[model samples]
Target: MSELGIEYQTVLGLPPVEFVHLAADLDCHHISMKVTGGGIYHHPAFSMLDDTALRQQFIAALRDRDVTISLGEGFVVRPAYELRDEAAALDVMAELGVTRVNTVTMDPDLPRSFDQFAIFTEMASDRGMTTTMEFAKSLTVTDLPTALQAVAHVGRPDFALLVDTMHAARSGNGPDDLLMLEPEWVGYIQLSDDTLAQRNPVYRDDSSDRRVPGAGEMPLVEMIAALPPVPVIGVEAPMRSLLAADTPVSECARQAVAGAREVLQAADELRETRARGCHR
Candidate 1:
């Protein structure tokens, strides 16, 4: 199985320093750090007075730990606004030598304007960064088919799907959902759980329900079995869940690692079972 990672938002509300330290301690291979708007570029620690310095510092941080960043969760809300930021961000990414990004859209009800998405997609490609779209239950590209449609429409190498465990479970996406995604369209997989409730509620509240991968009721094993070869698996359990019982960063990181192992083991078991059934 591939190594696991944690989204920046998943770590019990710890500061970046604590979170990164705990992730390294837990033996995580990478971390999904968000750089939306001006967060990373404008921050005091990562303060980049201009585009050049911003990109330089960003690369230095990643290189320091040899960690790869998976950015973008709610960045597509205002594409024009976000794309402009992405242009500056990509400039840094190109100079720093980063490779991929993960982003989610705010508007899930209507078709994307394409003007904004296309702009960023093109920019990322030019900079050699792969831009993957995360499918939220509330996004225009809600399901696998719709997301695939959008990817097909954009037809850009950087424009692909970044599957979220929370959205996939909330939307009741099954193995079929994984089957529908073209192998190339899949960029990275964010794994979490809706395990708070055994029987899904009528209104499955994602915020309250998000948990570590194996801890939740998501069909993670089945989903992983169907996923194409992916480079990263992100553990992005909700912040509250990490602190709901006053868990420490170290404990949360341990849980994250345990949860990932459970999911991967389950996936292997399911695959073996299916192979047996197919032969019989």
Candidate 2:
């Protein structure tokens, strides 16, 4: 099984420093760090760049655990968006050796958003990071084909797409859509499941209500099979119900890893069975 990553939302209330420790304790190979945005945006933290000492401590902890800061979150580009003092976030990312940054577009103008994405990817590349565009049913870039089109327009090697399983299904995409994606265009994938049969009327809540892989009706095994060989899989199930029940973050992380591994194992077994059948 690939090293499963835990995205920040799964343990939303935890401080960034403590979050890293939980991930390390869970033996997570990678973690998606959230440096900015909060409240309705779902991320509940500010810049980890404020305190140099704290940042160093965080880095040391990750290093000791051999965990990679595989992804960074909360970089958004929209019309009339001004690049504020992003130096803090960039500095922290550099120190942590983060490789990929997540971006979302809220601007209604598709053409303008493409130009903005180009600028964002250029900035991320300058800091030795790749920019990954995460498409959702709620976002302007709603599906894989549109995401591919946007990436094509940007024409940057460092720009890639993030396929979040729940969002893919909500956006009316399926395994065939995954097949259509050029492996090079995909950077990594977020694995999760949702019980909703269709897109929610208020899509914002979807982030908090996700289920651990294989806990719901999502065709997770098939989705895994459709992915490229050895894809970097980030388990991003943020079950608010569990959180309300006062469940330990460690337990949540543990269940997420087990569920994801189960999906992968089932997919592998099915593939082997098929291979044996073909030989017969």
Candidate 3:
């Protein structure tokens, strides 16, 4: 069974220390966070990159809670922003024991997109870190095919691909698409669910309007069974309704984890059944 972790998007506004506390309380040892901020979420005044005192306090939080930053967020490769510009942040993440970083390339030029992302992977590997590139319909690395192309272009040992359930469903990528990947090339598998009432791909809406893992229509069990031993399962559901109702981030996290545990348990059973079938 895979361990449970929280994607920062599920509780986007929480700062590093508070986020760590939440993760500990919920028994999630791994995390994907927006450390660079970059105006992506509610960034606190305390700096994870600068401000040594704050950084130390944040580190202490992680130590006390026994939680680790599984993946560093906000390494977005945009037309205006380059991955090279994030060297300082990369150094900080490495210091904080973050070995894997994640990004989405929004640049339109495929060649440039491929090159810049590969360069980002090189930079990460230089700092004793590995990196994962995420694909989304709203971004230039739109689907599984384009994602694999970028991965091939990069062709680095440390580079890996991140596949989120919502993107796969919305972009029409299925379990077979994942089978094409070599196990080592696959990185974190983010878990999320879409409304059975309406299933469509609208980046803005789907960005936050996601249901908990077992609450909706996604094939969470099959999706997990398709992968070859992923490092972690990230619960990335951000319920806008719950947030709007002033629900505590902790409550949302608890709900997400509960649903995720059920989904992952079912996935384990499915994998077992498949193995038995093959033997038969």
Best by TM-score: 3
Candidate 3: where is the Cα deviation over 4 Å? 38-46, 196-202
- The reply for model 1, stretches above 4 Å from the true place, is 36-61, 70-74, 79-82, 195-205, 241-244, 272-280
After superposing all C-alphas onto the true structure, candidate 3 shows an RMSD in angstroms of 2.2
lDDT of model 2 at position 125: 84
**What lDDT score is found at residue 75 in candidate 3?**
82
* Candidates' RMSD to native: 4.4, 2.7, 2.2
| Candidate 2 Cα RMSD (Å) | 2.7
TM-score of structure candidate 1: 0.79
Using Cα atoms with residue i matched to residue i, what is each candidate's TM-score against the true structure? Answer: 0.79, 0.90, 0.93
Better of 1 and 2 by lDDT: 2
lDDT tens digits, residue span 222-254, model 2: 877676644468888877777668777678778
Give the per-residue lDDT of model 1 (tens digit) for 1-280: 6567777656634444444566777777587654432232122333232544544555555566666655534346453345656566566555544577655565533455455566677777777777887666656566776677767778877677888766776666787768666788888887877653434343324453366677667778888888875877877775354455666656766776788878977887888898899999
| Residue pairs that clash (backbone atoms under 3 angstroms), model 1 | 72-103, 108-139, 108-140, 195-216, 195-217
Q: What is the Cα-based lDDT of residue 263 in candidate 3?
A: 89
